[model samples]
Target: MKFDKSELQIFANYCVAAAESMAYTLVRTAHSTFVKETEDFSCALASVDGLTFASPRTFGATWYVGLDYGPVIRSLTDYQPGDVCMTNDPYSGFVATHTPDVVMWKPVFYEGEIICFVAGHIHNTDMGGAVPASLSRTLTEIHQEGIRFPPTRIVDKGELNETLLSWMMCNVRAPEQNIGDMKAQIACLTTGERRVLEIVERFGVDAFKAGIGQLLDYSESQSRAVAKTIPDGRYFFAEYVDEDAVGGKPMRIALTLTVDDGLLQFDFSGSDPQLTSSLNVPTGGHPRHALLLVGLNYVLYSLNPEIFLNAGMLRIATCEMPVGSVLNPVEPAAVGMRSLTCVVVQAAVFGAFAQALPDRMPACPASSVCLLNVKTTDTSGRTIMASIGPVGGGAGGSSAGDGSDASGANMAFLRNTPVEINEAEVPIRIQEYGLVADSGGAGQYRGGLAIVMEFKVFAPNTLVTARNRDRTLFGSWGIKGGRAGRTSLFVRNPRTADQDILGNTDLVACQPGDVIRLEGNGGGGYGAPFRRTVEAVERDVRRGYVSRQEARERYGVVYEDGRVNAAATAALRADMAEGPVEANAFFDYGPNRSAHEAVWTRERYVALCQCLETVSVGWRFFLKHQMFDRLAERIAEGEPIDGVQIVFDLFAELKAQFPALAAQQARIKQVA
Candidate 1:
């Protein structure tokens, strides 16, 4: 408020420009294609208190608006001017949710005192692990994924620590690429430092400092105003992930959102326990850990497009996560596939808001990603290690419009790694890459189609590691009479008669000329399929997004020669008879999920999860696996089993064996 309107505008513009410039430097100097092509990086300018006050709007990952710098910043007691701290440890000062993302922070000083900090986060190509890419869906612990770093001063007082840098390189397979990427992070930070200094020297340090505080306050106010508009009440929604990557049994996530007086609280106490798989999210019990509110802030930003986005938005909501739950797993738990978990959190938040603001929300989003790594050999007997893709998943339908196509709505920041780059870098040929036809759920506003991609191996003995894969069983649910999106599929040798469906396999060895393909299911629809116009169905058929038979069956539409047969369509629609919907069926989750829920009702599942707390932490994985395997067997045998009693027996057996854990059961939901 101290400066005039024009002066304030100038300061804001300068900060944004500086952030964008930092991102530009990172992309241009980056060694890994993950940074240059996929653009999996973020940059921001934080005040001395470690609150992000400025970040680029059009560049970098957009989730930092929810990140916390206090945990890392408060621990740096020995910092000096020009010192840079580097970390990738999720439990340490890395602040990143996973190990693949290396975060670097450099202090920006003015008048020999720190005024602000510039930070950059980039995902390295590899960090030496059980698998090549350092991220495996089946990895049981974080230690197996890669070497981790605490907040170490890699650059002290303007001098690079060569010894420390070399030590980090010793743990990774791609030393040159990883170190180069780390240097790129430092370069971005240095660029930001120079830009911030320019602002301070031009506008004076006092004015620059005041401007930073004002900008943060301004962003916070914008968030508060938006929250204030929503009705004050409690909203609850329970959703399920496809499977606990180690097995095929579905996992559940419960959300309770309370909005009162322009403030929000998100609670995840009833969610399933932490898995042995790598899909857990180590949120460290922080409400504003940057990943929890990715969807909420996305909605907020969409509502107020011109509002400023930064850590100040963290002031909008508070979260309470049960300890040992999948979202708040203890240290050393594998958190490589956390983005998949985040997709559920995002959906849950959307569901909560839909209760208050249905017009603003979309149908369920297709949730899953496929990133495959191939290790093969060339003609000269030299081995070539390469990657396939972090394939884009389809997004859900919206009340305002149709959902996004193959590019996920929540992950619009992620771009496909180009096909040309993959072919050039490794011994694989692109057999097919296109949209999956008739996969999207039908609605008045149809859901977008999923992208189907296939590749053929060219080497004799190829080791293929599926770094992250999911959505093999249950699919995205629809809302307000919409249908559920189709689930994801991973197939091996799809072109041959003896094709095999891997069903989200973790790792495998493929021989020469083997083909593998992935079908990322489309987003769910937003309304009744029969309500869709005939013209739209005809166009969909023309574009190969919908088959003619599917158009007639799902939509009750008759089209010929790319034209709507009005008389025939009317008669067909009049006689169309579909299965009866359940009582007040606002959500249509398709048959697979509906069938699963028939046996694993909300009360039964939550009670079972709570009882499992009596089992010791070390034995919980095996016990849960046993329970799910039994349930899967019953489903496979076309028989109904007492899921609640099955869990009770499992818990009672484990508790009786280890009576010491019986008392620990009281600790369940203590954090709630």
Candidate 2:
């Protein structure tokens, strides 16, 4: 049953149609906002070996197109025809990136033979935890996060595991909604099984099996072809999460991508160790998790959008993550807030590729999704908790054009809940929802505008949780001389004289008439603002994206009478273009990263990484923490000091503080 080119393509399209049909069923039937509206659920058909063969293009999460089903499928002893195994624990199996995402898998059987597996996972709103949404950036361990279902049968051989399902639902705040969404996933998986069976019956089992295998191979070939276009070399970049939520220190995600002859090796061995916060990502050490979707999305998407996004692309690369690192944390480590970290992961990806594909990749984006939770008891005495709406993360500006505003450049699958839906489901009133003016970073191609939302709590004693909120301390970096995007903030009672500027918080209790304002960060800009055409500058000024004065100051384009002042614009450009340039003309890391790099110079940063390489991975995080603590202490003293000298001194202090572990880390100090 060897497939020729034409036959293989036709067969591939058929499988894709089946996958889309499955996802359509779920999207149509789901009750949770995360699934029905946000479209965070995904349905796929997998080969017997557990690699995804067909993924829906028109629906569900496109970022998880490369997820593997083999590990979890193999964890069980055996599965009957209608048996469905479910898991959300990242460490227990390769089922999900976090606990809130419940994954279910079923085997498709035809003619008394197993043909393929049908799998689907959706972001369940609540799963029983310390918080209503089961996601907390401050929560230190998974034990406090939620109920973890680790590869257990929720439906046994066509019979509903009612006892197990009901018991599980009783644990979450949104029991009815959670159960309904869980059933939606099961229904979609069952639909996938039915669709695959129909395809097998029509084409015959042998041809169907061959086609599924061929699909992955075809996708791999296309991915490899794209990989070849990237010059073979090592590209290095690092980015930080704004803060640990509980602590003020930033977290690092360092990556050195080695591209060689159409093969990509992502070396994250230099990343920081696991943290005591939910920000840790429980990736199960899988290279193709949602966080790593940056490389897959940027490269394959830019090159060929029609290629099958299956496990085939996974064959072209390997990821090297050190054990116990934040990306691959150990058991009991909180993983509720993985998406915020995903933002930094993309920064490292863009920063690295900016080195290799300067003209291709845009600057860093203020691209982290946020959740706003409201918890309170209804009049009937039943507790209610739900996410009010999805946070809008503006996309980074690109050479092709300005990034999409508010909707997001990444995680495009998660749609914002409608105002009507939020009002009806939760006890709150939406006061305002719109794009922030002058928030987008300025460049030849400007970044997208930030979204601002205000909500008034009408219910008494309402506890609100807005975890993983960031970018207030640091702005999104721009590239090619573009200025950084503006930062975000949490304002309380903005219209009143008692308006308080609240930065970021995990949770805050509120009463009736209390207002909360969330301003999402803008995406990074691309190219220099001054290099932008005067016409574009005038257009931005008119559109409220840039003010007339900002246009004159930032882009050197003086605007008057609703248009660019030609003579003044010419004079200003002449003055600016010839003036002394402070940074490189190629990349703009924004002021914060640039200032930090001045002291933590790339040379020093890399040297620090090398020095820690001598110590055990477990102790590296504490040592790094000590270094940052001492550096901050010195900086806070208001004494002008060199950052590089501070790092050297910090190492000496560490050596003296931990003499027993000096043998592990002092070698680095001695070498430096």
Candidate 3:
């Protein structure tokens, strides 16, 4: 059973290939647009203890790489060879499976003893909730989000658990589709199980385990080496989420990174309290989940192409997230849209690094993935819910150059939905999908530009649910002396008709000819614009990223006849002040705290969420709307605010006033 290094390498490769194959099969077989089109699913092989041994590189969010599967494995301790365990309850070690994601795990046995576990998760089209799709922005508790399944054997001894299956089917709107996807997940896990057994047969289980350990060790060593390269010191940074889905309050995330020797500790002590909304993250026991850790690792490892991705890289890094907070929510906490929290986590990581490596790190980019879901009755009156698009954001400016248009720095792999496919699949017209010019942050290395997407609903009363619409408080921040990117705007009409700003809600009816536009935020710049080269300014003007006036005013460069006026630019720069410009004011969720965070706190946000633990979907929607209205008034008035500074100052003051809050803030701020 003992194997050499070569044998271990081969076994590790086999596991990776098998997991990847499983992910491909799931994507090809699934029916939902979120799965098939967006490709939002993942597959992994884990030890019987629920620790991930191998994961797919192309599927799901990269953050789940470090997730531990022990909770799910322990829940299925009595599972037999033919049994399959399923659960989406955050409290039961499920980190935000929510309703759309149906997670299934199967045990792989070698010689009568369980040796490994195969898990496949997919985002189903519907999971029996208040709406056609199980997206609840304002859910206060888990029950209102959807049916909670604890670690339960969904398939026992090769037989389908009809009772459980029937109950799930009866609850969701798209039972057939959900059932089909579930079968697809089962098939994928079976494939992985078979492949894993083959690896064990060829290399022996002992050698296979050895290889896993070696791979992890190699990764950890490489990560430690990278950490050593970073100056040994404590660096702090912070990031934000504009609001919980219900818009009850803007959430702040702070990190204080302690880098001593080669060890890196990310403390999330100063983060905002747990919300009464569905944006909670269930970290299980791994502090913000393994997936997020994997994402951060990937980004750091990406700096050195030779570094291998394994548990070894994470050995030197640790995260401390407070329980009952947004990053590490407790039982019964509504976690339907935990991805929002994940986005903030990514921002925090970037923020912490920005402090340590200001010259190297880029300004903050527009972070969240905008989800637009359109639902309507087709010709035959059958309800159809299709993902209209996942809008892209601007990239952060780096030392090398300005960010690419519509490129997300952290989420570089994300892609926009094809227009041809959208038109063919649904009754809608794509009016405009192009970059928003002059939106990039002005700097020596300018920030990337966001996109302006406009579409019209062809059918009557088409329900539109657009989430992550505004960046009022959490607009991307600049590093060094760079400028912040423009905030995003969601308007019903542009130029011609009166427009209504959209908020988080169940449905907004749109008639034919009504236009909807989403202008995503640009990323922050890295340095002062006046320091930029004349050639760079000219190129931006030629490419439409900068207008002639903006180039002269922001960059202190003048352009004429599509070419830079070198003499004029030099003169302008000479006249420009040399000292650092004032930092842009902070953005706020609303005009006042009473209109934003105060409303949620007044509603006993934590208590409200606890009560919602057993409520229905409709009730969750009502609660979210109620909270949103109170915050929206503040958001509307807080017009042109600095969200980052507000949260940063508020958390700083809170930590000073209360020791417990300070301890929590310290944990969160440590990674900053």
Candidate 4:
């Protein structure tokens, strides 16, 4: 069963190829535009114990490379050769994370014995809920998001579960699309079964199992090697979601990353408590939850691109997520918009790693990706649901070079649907789709440019939802004296007489002739702007990526007669170097965040967390909001504020006003 390194490498390639083939099967045969064109799906091969060993490198979403299927597999009492299990309940096994994402797995048997499993998931365009797409930050409960399925057999003993399929079809808005996509997933799993059997026949069942173990071990070793290169220390970082919901207060995600020797521990203790909105992430408090370590995956890949992609790669890291926090919410808490929260999670991890590996890490990326979905009717009045492709933001600038323009950094797997395909399939007209000039932050290496999408709907009473629209208020932070990126903007009838600016609004009712425009956030810059060569700035202006005015103001690059003025540019740079710097010399979080943080400092945040720890989960979010309102009032009244005292005083007043709250607090005290 033992094999040399060269042999292991060859076996690894084979497994990867199998996973890639499975991914292609799903993409080519899927029904919805979200799955086939956008490619918002994943496929992997796992051991019988449910630890993924191989996944596609260049296909599908990379979020599930470290997904653990053990909990769900064990929940089933029995499995047959043709049995395929499916689930979308986040609380059931914490596998799907959201209702729209349906996860499926099939037990692969070779020679009448189980050897491995083939698994994957696809994002359903619509599942029938309060909103058209079944996902919105405004949704307050999981039930509002969509109907959920627990870990159950959709296929048993090679027989289709007609009853279960009917139930699913009845609940969803687009039954045909869902059923077609499900069949494609089944076909993909069948392909995986065939390919896995081929591997087992060539290597023998025993040797195949042994090779899987060795491959996992090799991936773990590679991750540990990368970890060892990072300096040992506790790096703390915090990021904020624009708001828990539309027109709501901000929700913070804090992290304390401790790296000792070659191991890493991420403690998300100071994060905000579970919100009433769907932004909560349901992880079942698992230490190695895939959502918590998505940023770490990107970091490790950046550190060592050759590192193996498997569950073992994530084995080096562990997360400590508070039970009631946004990162690990309890059941019944809506998780429809958990993907948006994970963006902030990724940003927090990247921020922490930037401190530990300052030289290696880039500035913060535009961690916002807006998924645009349209629910409109045809001339026949039949309901139609389709995704109009994702509008992703720019990547952060790095020491190597300027960041990629209008690129999806972490969520790059969700490919953009072509304009021709979208217009043909959906009732919409694509007016403009291109990058915005002067949108990226200025630095020695400028950040990537943001995207601008303008589309007009053709039907009356059409519903559209732009999920995960963020970074409008607080832009991506720039590091090493660089400037923050541009903020996002959403407008209806933009540049017209009736232009309505919709900030962070996910759902909207559109009439015919309504032109909706979405301008996404840009990536943060790296290093100082004045340090950038004038030639580079001029080139950006020439390419229309940066405007001449912005180049002069932000980068101190002067232009005269459509050419760079070397003498004047040097003078401008000299004057710009003496400008007043922000409070944090290392990070430029833009004026909006800087103004917000000026009041809500670290000490106040610590005090807020300490006070929230005393309250029960049900009372935590309410009490925190009340305390924040009181703090703001005190600030406006021109009184010196003490965060701890303010929170305590507010809690005392609230308890006295509400007898039920006082009784609950007494009961909690008695229990403690």
Could you tell which candidate, 1 or 4, scores higher by lDDT? 4
Tens digit of lDDT per residue, candidate 4, span 1-672? 887999999999999999999988998899999999989998989988899999998889878888898888888977888899999988988989999999999999877888889998999998878998899988988999888899999999999999999998998989999999999999999999999889988888898999999989999999999999999999999999998766888889999999999999999999999988999999998899988999998999999999888999989999998888888888789999999999899999999999998888988888998999999988888877999988877888988888888787876457888899998899889999999887788888888888888999878889889999888898998899878899999999998899999999999899999999999888999999999988788788889999989988999988899888989999999998988876579988899888788777877788788777777888888887887787788889999876557666777888888798888878878989
Off by over 4 Å in 2: 287-290, 378-382, 561-563, 610-620, 636-648, 658-672
Please provide TM-scores, in order, for all candidate models, with all chains considered together: 0.93, 0.94, 0.83, 0.98
TM-score of 4: 0.98
TM-score result, candidate 3: 0.83
By TM-score rank, best first, the candidates go: 4, 2, 1, 3
Clashes of each: 1, 0, 44, 0
Candidate with best lDDT: 4
lDDT of 3 at 20: 86
Model 2 Cα lDDT, one tens digit per residue, 506-544:
677888888999998888889878888888877777777
Q: How large an RMSD does model 4 have?
A: 1.2
Using lDDT as the measure, name the better of candidate 2 and candidate 3: 2
On TM-score, the candidate that comes out on top is 4
| Candidate 4 or 2, higher TM-score | 4
The CA lDDT at 310 in model 4 is 91
